[model samples]
Each structure stands twice: as C-alpha cells, then as structure tokens.
Target: MATTHHTNETPTDVASNGTAPTSTVSPETLLDYYRQMVEVRLFEEAATRGFRQGKVGGYLHVYIGQEALARGFLDAFRKGDKTITAYRDHAHVLFQGGDPKATMAELYGKGTGLVKGKGGSMHLFDVENGMWGGYGIVGAHIPLGVGMAYSEAYRETGNIIQLYLGDGAIHNGYFHESANLAGLWGKDGMCPCLFIIENNQYGMGTSVERATANTNLGSKFDSYAIPWEKVDAMDLEAVIAVAHKAVDYVRETGKPYAVEAMTYRLGPHGAADFLEQYRSKDEVREARKRDPIGLLEQRLLDLGVTDEEAMEKIRAHAKELADEAVKFAEESPEPDLSELTTDVYAPETGLI
Candidate 1:
C-alpha cells in the first residue's frame, strides 16, 4: 500500500526544493483564494447555526474543513468548464458565482431560492455558472457527469467537466460503470473529465479502511486505464498546483483523469449525526491541527501577501456576508402553493 503523509511546508518551500512556482498564477489570485476560503468557512459555520435553529430542513451537510479542495480547483476554472458534485455542495455553488442569498433562501425553502425553493440543500443548480446539480443519491451524478462530458465532446465545444464525489461513492456500481464508459469515451478524445475524489477518510460512519479491501482510492481508476494522483488537501498551494496540471492535461489531451484529495470532515456527516459513534474525538482534534483555512492563513502571512490585520478584516467581511445571507433568507417569503405544479413538467413547445 502507498503511504499517506502530511506536510507543513508552504508552496514556495516545496517549489524551492526543485520545481519552481508557476509564473502565470499571480499574488492577487492567491489573495483571492484566501478571501474565498474564509467566505466559505464562515458560510458553512452560519449554515450549521441555521440548521440548529430550524431554518434549514432535511439533511444538512456543510463543507466545513474541505474548503481548500473546492477553492483550489474552482480557482483554475475556465469559461467552457462545467462542474457537478454530491450533496455537500453549498461552498461549491457559492465559489462558482451562485448567489449566496438565493442559496441561503433555498436552505430556508423560500421562493427566492436558486431552484425556487424546490431543490433545497442537496439540489442547488445554476446552469449559467455551469453548476449542473448537487445529487443527493450517492454516486448517481457520476454517470451524469460523464454524460455531460460526452455531450460536450459530441457538440465539439472543447469544454471540460469537473466531477466531484465523496470517498463513499466510489464503492457504488454507478461509479464503476461511469469510469468504464469514461475510459472508452476518452479513447476518441470525447471525454475531458477530471474526477476529483474527496476522500475525507470516511463514508458517513465507516472509514475507508473498513469499507474497502484496497484503500488507495485514486488507484481505483487504474482498472479503467485512467491516470490518477493523490494530494494533501490541507494545503491549498499543493492542491492548486495539482489541480492546474490535471485540468490542463484533460483540456489538452481530451482524456479523463482522477485526483484523490486526502482531506477530513471536521463536522458530522449531517446536522443530525450528533453521536459520531464511529470516530474518536482525538482523531478529530488531530485533524483540526491541519485545518485548511488556518494553513492558508499562515501561508499568506509567511509569503507577505497580507498582514494579520488585513487577514482579520477579511474574516470580518466574510462573517458579514454570511450574516446578510441569513437575513435575506429570513426575509424571503416561502414558496407559494401555486408553485407546487409550476415546474412539474416542461412546456408543450419542447423541453427547455
């Protein structure tokens, strides 16, 4: 088995060892990453509070500790790129230019939501932003992502698809089927998809060790002849570096690739998963030491990108945005009864 390791080195340190940092990514981009990460963290924290207060119903899965993984990849997104992911998707939508007010209103089941309050937390969608939908069913979106890539290729659009899935979804037959087809389709240069496996070590209560005979999640793509790699999710720079390379490879070669990000969920699987019976507090505590937001904050300071005061100001601004989102949701009206039958089917003219 390949050994998993952790690192505290900044991106510059890693590059200085031999590989130089890419010249294209500027200091402004790095600062923006830090700001976005802070915004996501604050947003999720507010969502958790809202869930506790009964503002949000159904299952609530906040992207707390896994901010860096999404931020890293989405930062590298281009005009023709599309993205899809699982239910833990609030951050994904927000980072991709989805309206925070509408997202929060969706959580509150208000008519002003992105999906008109019908989709709620798990089904956020924004076609304009190229965010398809966040699937509630485990592994269901895998096939959909591949299908989207195929459609893009068929249309000769040269667009890339970014498909995100959790560690647990890999065990599903849907994932395997999609991978097999992605491999076949890539042979014709028809599938430019980057399958990102957000391996947070557990699929709900079960750890990867308990769930799989072979725990190297990235290597699972080997069966389909797809290239794969693993990266430390705690480090934004590391993730950004790898993400740029992966996206470039898919864009240039028109093939599928996989990246297993070794990350951890600092919160319960959902708002109701209070017991957390599967893991110990010590394990959670240890993981907190490598908190992605904190890691990035320190890196920014070390790199002289910003000072402590400026960082704190960013944190305050993020919190203000999150607070305003909640207020927007609170003020937004609930979906009217007439809305029940409005979006049930397409118009007679044709499916729009």
Candidate 2:
C-alpha cells in the first residue's frame, strides 16, 4: 500500500496517512484525558484482582496500555455518533460514559451490569451512550458497524460511526466485505465511518508479521480506496491530533476513513494467557517505557498543567473510584432465571 505524508499544515488541514501538528489544546482538556487514562488503568488493575479472586467469571481482557487510543479517539466523537468494537471493550465502554459500577457488575455477572449480567466481559452494550455493543467473535461487528453507517446515511442523520477492531480482525473476510461496501457506498458521500485499527503488535500471541504478508495494517484500507493514517498511540496529544483529522475527513466528505493506532498491550492477551509463549517478558518490560498512561502523566507535569501533588491526588481518586465500583458490583444482585427468555424476543403482541 502506498503511504502519503503531509507537512506544513495544522491538524485540521491535514489529510489521511499523515501526522497532524499538535495545537494549543487547553490544560483542562489535557488533564481530563490524563484522568480518564488513570481511571481506566486503575479499573483494569482492579478487574485483574477481581478475576484472580474469582469474582469475575468468563474470560478477562484488560486495556492496561491502550487507554490513550480509546480516550483520544472517543473524545473526537460528536452527538449521535455510534461506536462498535470487538470483545476487548471494557475500556471503550467506560470511556463512552458507561457507569463504572454497572460495568464491573456485568463482569461479576450481576443484574446491575450494563447488559444485566448476560453479556459478561465481552458483550457490553449501552445504547443510550451510542455504544452499540462489543462482539465476542472476531470481525463480527465490522458488518454491523457498516450497517450503522448505512442507516445514518440513509436517514441523512449526518452522524458517523466509529468502528474499532484489532489487528487480528483485519484478516477476517467480513472486514474486507464491510470495507468494500463502505468504499462503494461512500462514493455517494454518505457512508461516514471511521475504521480504527488498534494494532497492539500481537493478535493474541501471533505477531502481525507472522500472520499477514503486509505488516502495514493501514495500507489494507488502500485496497478499498479508503484514506488511511497511522499515529503513535503512546502520545495522547498525537492520537487526539490525528483522530480529529480522521473524524473531520469522514464528516466533511461523508466518506469512510481509517486510522491505525500503533500501540502495545502491556499485559497478556487475556487473564488466562499465562503461558505467553509467543513473546518474552523483556519485550513487555521494554514496551512499558512508552506506557500511554505514564506518558500522559509526565506530559501533564512537564507542561506545568499539573504538579506531582495534583497527579498523586488524581491517582488516589481513580483508585478510590475503582474500589467503589468493586464494592457496588459485589453488592449488586444477580438476574433472576426468569429473565433468560424475557428479552430474547419482542412482546407477543407485536410492534405498537
């Protein structure tokens, strides 16, 4: 795939496959991003502990190192925008204004969870927040997201859909199908969708180089003629800057766009992935130096946006919030067995 490089332009002026120059973002905004990352990190850490204690059932995937990707891109979302992603979605839900207690409760298999304890770790859905839901199957949600983009275009809603998937998902046939349709529909300037690829280096144990012939994931969109870009997910500002450009391109052109966020997951693929035979501990340790949360915190401090005391206070608050969520999850009640068949279908009376 051919890559395009753009220079001497502001973030808003830049096109796809190019880095955008960071502008004067407000201190409060930067701090809020830092706080969100901290909260997610704390929540994931608590979730790890919860899994260890057997409080959470099913598989556990924590977004320890990829907080910036969610925080930065989600911040670019506008009203009526819809989002969908694969199973590694707790962080996405939380960043989309999901209740921490409800999220944790869902993991605990309680009724108070986002999906009433049924979805568990993978299928978190909060329609009110425009988070369509997370899919357990690899690449399954790609078509669903494209459908959403079609609906928005058909209804003339002027709303875009932000679809997220991992590096591994790009290999699925459904992803290609959706991308091809998005490119086709976008020809009329109506399929506004931002396909975000969270390239965390490894797709559950298999590295990108080992799985695909082309390691440049963004270039995959080139086959569909969709404009693509890549950004350093470790840098919060860079993510935000590039994300704004991507989102704007979709909104302005009423077309599809792609952004490949170069990042790494500090933890194993899942809680049960203890063997970790594919990668070494030293690789993870070295990657920790570029930790998104830590990088944002240091940026905040260096910019005089906040001091160590303030950061410590934020950390404590985040930890307290996570602890409170755990307590709420523990006290929450489980769904009754009767509910199993209730929401499975529409009312017998049919639509009103």
Candidate 3:
C-alpha cells in the first residue's frame, strides 16, 4: 500500500517519523545500485569536463549529489512506465535505460544524438525507452505529464507516469493546476501519476528556503488531497524502500502519489555557474558527507558485500565507460543541413 500521511502533513513529518518501512533489499541489489551510482558520478564528471572544454553546449546541469533519487526510484519502474522531468535530466534519461553515447552526443549536438541533435542538453527524448524528453522550462512539463497520465488512465493502459520536478516548480501555476486535475482524476482511481519532487535545496541560484514561504514541498500536495511523504534521498536504501511502496501503490490503485526526495545539488546549479555566491562552501562540504555513492559504499562495506579492490575496479570501469561516451560524442557528426525541415511536425497524410 502507498504510505499515507495525516491531513496536511509536512515534509518534516515523514523525514522524522520513518513513515516508509526500512529497506529490505538484498545485498546483490544494493551492490548493483551502487554500481549505477558510480557510473552516474563518472558520467556527470565527464559532462562537467565537456562543458568546461566547450564540447558541450547549452545549460549543463549534472546530477552529482542527487543520483540516488533517480537511481533508487527508477529501480522500481516497470517496462511501460513513463518519466518526465525538468532540465536537470541527464541522470533521469540515463537511469531510464537511455544509451550513454547517444545522450552525450545529444549534449554535443551531434546527428547521432538521442533526438537527432535537434534537442541539446535540456531536451533529451527517447520515447522507445519511456523517457519522454526533459523540458527546459520550469513547471512547463507538469501539465503535459498530467495529460499523459490521464491518457493512460482513459485508455486503461495499466501504466503510470513518474513525473519529476524540482522544488522551485511546486510554487508555479502549472503545478497547482495539474496537481488539481491529478487529484480529481485520482478520486476515481484513474490517474496513476507518481509525483517525485527532486528537492535539491536550490532552484538555480535561489535556495528553497528563500524561494517559498512554506519549505515543505510535499505538504503542498495535501491541498489536492494527494497522499505525500518525504524521504532522505541521500540514502539509496531509504529511497528504494519508499519508492517501491509508492510505485506499487500507484500501480495497484491507479491513483496519484507524491514523494518529496530531500536531496542537495552537490555541484553548482550548472556548469556555467562558476561563482555560487548564494551558498557557502562549508554547506556544500557538509552535504558531501551524505553523498549517496559514499553512503552506499559504506553500507556495502558494512555488509561485506564488496571491498576496496572491487570498488576500485568498479570506478575504473565506470570511468572507461564515461570516456568512451565522450569519445563517441566528440567523433559523431553534426545534424545534416536537410534536418532543418524534418521533425517540425507530424508527416502529412492523405485521406482520399
């Protein structure tokens, strides 16, 4: 069953209350999650280098500290499940089974890119893989995600939408309107949309505390009568425990649910954000202690699932994969001149 909170429950309630059951994932699964995290870390680090060297263009929002949220939640994703998120979305697509080379090529604006180089870093689309393109606009995709979920509900597809958004978007008009419709449709057990709020503390340079009067993004869902809770996204186990329940609940009941993943953006908002004047260095330093990859490593060590040698090997392999992706992106060809007229709209049809 989907874990539920009392009426108007704040994010702090679940963060302190242990509303989600403790994770009982096997050691083997934990190790796999750790491997994925390592791969993501290496991939993001490479992306940062690419952005700095001018190989990657447009805004580069690497998911450094916030890997576990996507890593853990997506572990529970079914084959037909759909994911939509904001611009900080490379991790989402990667975790959703997207090809690393194609994703990097997209960032490089190569013709071999995921969306044929039409969409840059902020617009990756792999519909065949269920990643429905990341939006460059804040709150812009909320209505679209909701509409998609409603479509599934109407068609009885037995599928759901993993609609991800940042804390900043919760205050936007689109969020409120779409959430209202989700709640209304959910009353009939129809809209199976799992709202995963990736609250990484900051929406660009503005901190969540400064951006909203009510800092508990989860509680905002209460207004629409949607069951919501918060999880410490820094721990993979904690995230898995909650995400499994939430995904199962949404799938079984065909209703909307929300999980506010409390996480931090370890890196600057984007690669171009060289001088993060808003936050202190000490804060970022402290947040590093809770790095999901580090935390997962510690747990793996505790359980004797892996040791230093294995971890080192994993790191090396991940780095090699990242390097290969970079090379592919660099060598890939740019969009052809004829591409300008293609993919502008659906192909015309004749009914005669």
- Of 1 and 3, which scores higher on TM-score? 3
Structural similarity to truth (TM-score) of each candidate: 0.92, 0.94, 0.93
Would you give me the overall lDDT of model 2? 0.86
Which of the two, 1 or 2, has more lDDT? 2
Question: Residue-pair clashes per candidate, as listed?
Answer: 0, 1, 0
Q: For residues 76-154, could you state the per-residue lDDT of candidate 3 as single tens digits?
A: 7777889999999888888877888999999999999999999888998889878997899999999899889888888
C-alpha lDDT (0 to 100) for residue 189 of candidate 2: 85
Please give, for residues 1-352, the per-residue lDDT of candidate 1 as tens digits. Answer: 0011111122222233446334244566677777887887888888889999998999899888998898877755776789999999988888888888899899989999989999999999988887888899999999999999998888988788999999999999999999999999999998999999999998999999999999999999999999998889888877877777778778777899999999999999998899999999999999999999888888778778999999989899989988999999999999998888776677674433
lDDT, model 2, position 283? 93
Model 1: which residue pairs collide? Answer: none
Each model's lDDT comes to 0.85, 0.86, 0.86
What does each candidate score in C-alpha RMSD?
5.9, 5.4, 5.9
| Candidate 2 regions with alpha-carbon error over 4 angstroms | 1-20, 348-352
**Model 1 lDDT at residue 7:** 17
Q: Which stretches of candidate 1 lie over 4 Å from their true place?
A: 1-24, 349-352
